[model samples]
Target: MFTPQGPTLRELAAQALSSVEHGYDLLAPKFDHTPFRTPDSVLDAVGGALRPMGPFESGLDLCCGTGAGMDVLAMLCDESVTGVDISAGMLAVGRERLRADGPPSGIGERGPSVAWVRGDARALPFGPAFDLVVSFGAFGHFLPRELPGLFAQVHSVLRPGGRFVFPITAPPRPSSPWYWALLGFDAVMRVRNALWRPPFVMYYRAFRLGDVQRELAWAGFAVELRALPEFGYRRDGSPRCRMVVATRGGGATPV
Candidate 1:
């Protein structure tokens, strides 16, 4: 899944041995070349799904590694877009990508301004200053127990009725090969953490939709699910991908 520009096997081993923050810092330079980066297709799908609900003002991209989600924010938000990450290296690369790529398509000549901040997702450094927040492909770094705190942080950063949106894929069935693959991946990660110092937390199976929905509600969000038609549905007739729109209640804002 990794391209030639991606990290070497030895380099990846070194990163796997480091702490999560430091590991991402080391991998930041070649991250987009790796399969770890969120696919453009997913980004486009989310952006399309959110367009009708948006026209949002200020937006935040929580755990915004390499600022992939910021592109979507630029398309949806009118004023400004901020990307927060724990890794300085990742933020630096994100800034470079912004500079090189310029504004995303569909944004006007006076597109939303962009900024990068280095901060943990559990304790964001902003007030309730954002109208919307979006994240992509960064949840696995957080353990299952951290969901409440993480969702709370997102809630705290958003204005009342503002949305905290992210796309989640339906879990693979027990009969599917992907199910066993992810199960084995999580098992390996558990063993690695058991044996190593400064754990690099990345598990594929830990973030379940039921658990996440409950945590979002506890964190004070009225949650809704929107199917992304682009990815289609499973043979079981469930959506392959759905966007979770968690609105911090109290106001009547449509989104």
Candidate 2:
């Protein structure tokens, strides 16, 4: 669902027909107003979960649309934080927001600084330079086939023992309305891609937990899932949401 400030139906239709990058570029200005943006609650939960693991030196926000994940990085990392996204329009909005917020201060001589980089997630233009990396609500942009390469790229950019953290909500059960809604969305997306140019590779049901864990392991990450207690549990007693923390294999790096 979208707000009055969000993209109109016609604008959304135009975006859907465009390439993923162009679609996001068109949607960038109004992205934060849409339900598609990562919610503040999820971000806060992630920040709280990551605080104990950090005091990290440098951080990266992968696929950082409008830099929402940068807030989590700022809380955990002491030195600097970089938000990377493919859309120039998104980066522009992110840069302006960060500038307005100013650098975060406290706990050290240098406060956390924010930088925006425009680039593809599959081919990140960075070395093993980051002590922590995080992405929020951006996984659907990559198809299942792309997960391996995407995780590998994140691994490449992280220092050994650095983490790639993100929160994942448990899939809705078959009886749930959310389940049918997502199924319908994926079905429509499939049809749209079949009949249109520049396919948008976003599918709600495609990113299975088992497959994702296996791919992360293959990409040299030791994975763990921490339950986000703020969201409570499902009827079966499983966590409603969990934060996936994948640390690159090796000894822990100094903060």
Candidate 3:
């Protein structure tokens, strides 16, 4: 669901028809008003979970749309924070927002200096320059096959023992309404891509936890899952949402 300031039906239609980058570019102005943006509650929970792991140095927000994840990075990292995204329009909006309000003044005068770079996640431009990396709600854009390269890139950019952290929710059961809703959405996307050029690669059901963990292991990360107790657990005693913390090993081996 979108707010009054969010994209209109026609605008949504136009965006859905375009390529992911172009669609996000068109939607950037109103992205924060839409449900698509990561919620503040999840952000707060992640910040709380990561705070104990700090105080880190340089941090990176992978696929950082409008720099929402940067807020979490700012609280944890002391030196600096960088947000890398592929959409110039999204980066422009993020830059303007940060300039207008500025980062919170909590961590002293330097205040975790923020920088935005336009780049792809599959091929990060930086070296082993970051101590921590965080991404929020951006995984659907990459297909299952692309996980290896994506995780490898993240591994490449993080320093030894650095982490790539993100929250993942357990998929709803087949009997749940949310399951049917997501299935319908994916079906429509499949039909749209079948008939259209420059296919958009967002599919809700594509990113499986088992597959993801395996890929992260293949990419030289020691994977671990910590329960986010704030979201509570399922009837089977499994966590509804868990933060996946994949730590890069100190060894200089290629994944």
Give the number of the best model, judged by lDDT. 3
For each candidate in the order shown, give its overall lDDT on alpha carbons: 0.91, 0.88, 0.92
Model 3: weakest 10-residue lDDT segment is: 102-111
Weakest ten-residue segment in model 1 by summed lDDT: 246-255
Alpha-carbon runs more than 4 Å astray in model 3 = 253-255
Model 3, residue 203: C-alpha shift (Å)? 0.7
Write the residue-wise lDDT of candidate 1 on 1-255 in tens digits: 999999999999999999999999999999999999989999999999889998999999999999889988988998999999999999999999878887677456788888899999988999889999999999999999998889888888899889999999999999999999999988988999999999999998888999999999888899999999899999978999999999998743221
Off by over 4 Å in 2: 101-109, 251-255
Better model by TM-score, 2 or 3?
Answer: 3
Query: Pick by TM-score: which candidate is best?
Result: 3
Look at candidate 2 and give me any clashing residue pairs: none
Give per-residue CA lDDT, model 2, range 52-170, as digits (tens). Answer: 88789999999998988887787788788899999999999888876777644442356777688999999899989999999988888898999989998988889988899999899
Please give, for residues 1-255, the per-residue lDDT of candidate 3 as tens digits. 788999999998899989999999999999999999999989989989989988999999999999899888888888889999999999999999988886665445867777899999988999999999999999999989999989999999999999999999999999899999999999999999999988987899898999999999999999999999999999999999999999999976365
Q: Which 10-residue window in model 2 sums to the lowest lDDT?
A: 102-111
